[model samples]
Target: MSVFSDIFFGGLFQGSLYAMMAVGLALVWTTIGVFNFSHGVFMMLGAYFAWQLVAFGLPVVIAFPLAVIVMAGAGWILQASVVRPLIGRPNIVLVVVITTLAAGSLIENGALTVWGPRSKQLPSLIEGNTTIAGVGVSLHQIAIIVITPLILAALWSFLNRTRLGLALRAVAQNEDASQLVGLNVTALYGLAFAIAASLAGLAGIFMGGYRFMNPSMGADPLLKALIVVVFGGISSISGPIFAAYLIGFFEAASNYYFGLYWTPALLFLVLIATLMVRPEGIFASRSRGLA
Candidate 1:
């Protein structure tokens, strides 16, 4: 029973991280109509930024915000420079592939040039551990579990209640109509990219606390984010959050009962089964074509 509880809660914690990581990817897709393959690289950059700040004797609080701000600025620049130039091109697939390759090469080369190819650790924002219902867990993990939902709630409120949020939603619903109504589509895209980058930066900070940071760490999270987005349905924000927990639980359980190597196999099997069962995704409201 204790083992089950540990797995359950631990899964929830990990799921929250995955959800945070994937939300940015989903936002860019839903709002900007672009599949940003570079989202994970932004996360990598955030972690590196935070690590560098800590190395320079900055506190975690300051480092965190600095990382976010830097990444947000980077997002703005990427949009203005790279993405902006590709606007109105029919070959979106080419653009996505090119951006992805560029992100990967840039991160790899940048890390090698600047920080070298060494993995580094960051100080945990929350220290110590606590026992909950007979299960011992790290307080940092607990903090992640707590913080993820609060961020999500805040995001929900931002999108639902704020004027810019409503405008973003309007753009997502009908870009042509939004433009007709005098919305700056280009500015909206930039905002979407900024928000997406911010979310990724948050995930990077959380990840840095949970584990070590390296240049290549983004690859796994990037793959997981993509899977979560697909599993949750491309159009529904709620779907990714829910599916992230599901995937997390499955991964934890698989790691516990079977070998760690089997976890990926199990995840793939479950993903395949899920697609077979619900082609549009569990929480997907409409077909992909309609979305």
Candidate 2:
């Protein structure tokens, strides 16, 4: 029973973090029709930004939000400067992959030069531990479990209920049609990048709260998020969210039965098998919109 509880809660905790990381990737993929290889660097940079602010004597409340804002700006700049020019070019998909990969490398090196190789930790929002179903868990974990849904709900409302969100959704569905309808497609693309970066920033903050963060900390999460996104399907936001939790639980079980080192190998194996069976993803939709 104790082991079962550990797996259950551990999976839930990991699933929440995976959802945060994967959803942003899915958003960018669906909106721009390409992947940002630099997405993980955005997470690393955001966490570093928050850590810097805290080190400078700012509170976590202010530092975290500001880090997200800075990341939003970074995202917009990346879209405008790097991605925008290649939008309609020949072989743009391959070009974007290369460019974003280069950009991510540059950013990671920049982070290393700026922050050094030392690992830093962020203070948790809450301190203490609690018991659930005969298992002990940190309050921070509980907070994360509770807060993740609320953030996701707010994001859902923004995408489904707001005008700008509807516009984004429209652009995702048919970019040419959106432009024909007088929508500023370029600006919307920037907005999509901005939102995606901000979410990645938040995920970084969440991870930093519990784990020691270094310049390269985002890479693992990035790979896992890619797996979750591919597994969940990038056609809609809901698909990745469901996939995140499912993968999270699977990861927990794998970790318990197989051990840490074997987990990544197992995940990749599962991904390969899943792709062989369903290349489009388990919950993939025929439609191309974020809804």
Candidate 3:
């Protein structure tokens, strides 16, 4: 029972973090109409940015927002300068895949040059741990468990209650129609990318507390985000959110029971099974049918 409680609660917190990362990817897909292979790069950069800011004498509160804003700006630039140009070209999906892969590589190499190959972790926001149902959990973990839903709620409010959010939804539903209605489709795409990047940045900042930051850090989250997003539903926010936590719990439980090495294989198995059974995802789409 003790072991069960440990894995359950530990995975709960960890999976909430994963959900945050996945949510960013899902947002980009739903809005920008492309799977961002470079999403993880944004996360990596965010963590590094925060560290750099602190090294330069900024407080955590200030550093965090600055890092997020920087990442968001990069996302905006990526969409505006790089992605937008190729979006209408032939074999757009393939082009985007190549471009983003290349971009990720560049970002990784740049980080290696700037921060070196050694891994680094951000300072913990809180010290010590708390017992939950007799299971010990760190303050950082508890913060994650508490904060994810709040962020999601805030996002929902923004999306449902704001004009820009409505414009974004309009563009996502039908780009042509939105443009025909005199909407600035380009700006919407950039804004979506910015929001997505900010989410990734926020996840990165939180993750820095638990894990070491490396140039290749984003690689894992990118894969995880893809898995959750695809498994949850492509066109809806809610499905991926649910899928992230489910996958997170499964991963933690599997790691505990099957050992660390087998966890990857187990995750792949789950992904394959989900793909076989529900290729369209476990959740319904916001439109005609679940994407």
Q: Candidate 1's residue-wise lDDT over 178-247, tens digit each?
A: 9999999889888888888888878888888878888877878888888888888878678888888888
**What tens-digit string does per-residue lDDT give for candidate 2 at 6-84?**
9999999999999988988988888888888888989988888989899999988898899999999999999998899
Q: What is the C-alpha lDDT of each candidate?
A: 0.83, 0.90, 0.84
Checking candidate 2 for backbone clashes, the offending pairs are none
RMSD of each: 1.6, 1.9, 1.7
lDDT of 3 by residue, 1-291 (tens): 888888888678767877888887877777767888899998898899999998899998888889989988988988886689987776777888889889889988999998999989987777688887888788988887888899987887777799888888888888899999999998989998898888888888888888999888888888988888888987878888888888888888888889989998888887888778877787854356333
Q: What's the ranking of the predictions by TM-score, best on top?
A: 2, 3, 1
Better by lDDT, candidate 3 or 1: 3
What are the runs in model 1 whose C-alpha is more than 4 Å off? Answer: 287-291
Better of 1 and 2 by lDDT: 2
Q: In model 2, which regions exceed 4 Å deviation?
A: 286-291
Q: Using lDDT as the measure, what is the rank order of every candidate, best first?
A: 2, 3, 1
TM-score of 2: 0.96
Looking at model 3, the pairs that clash are 285-290
Query: Any residue pairs clashing in model 1, and if so which?
Result: none
lDDT of 3: 0.84
lDDT of 1 at 101: 67
For residue 74, give model 1's deviation from the true position in Å: 1.3
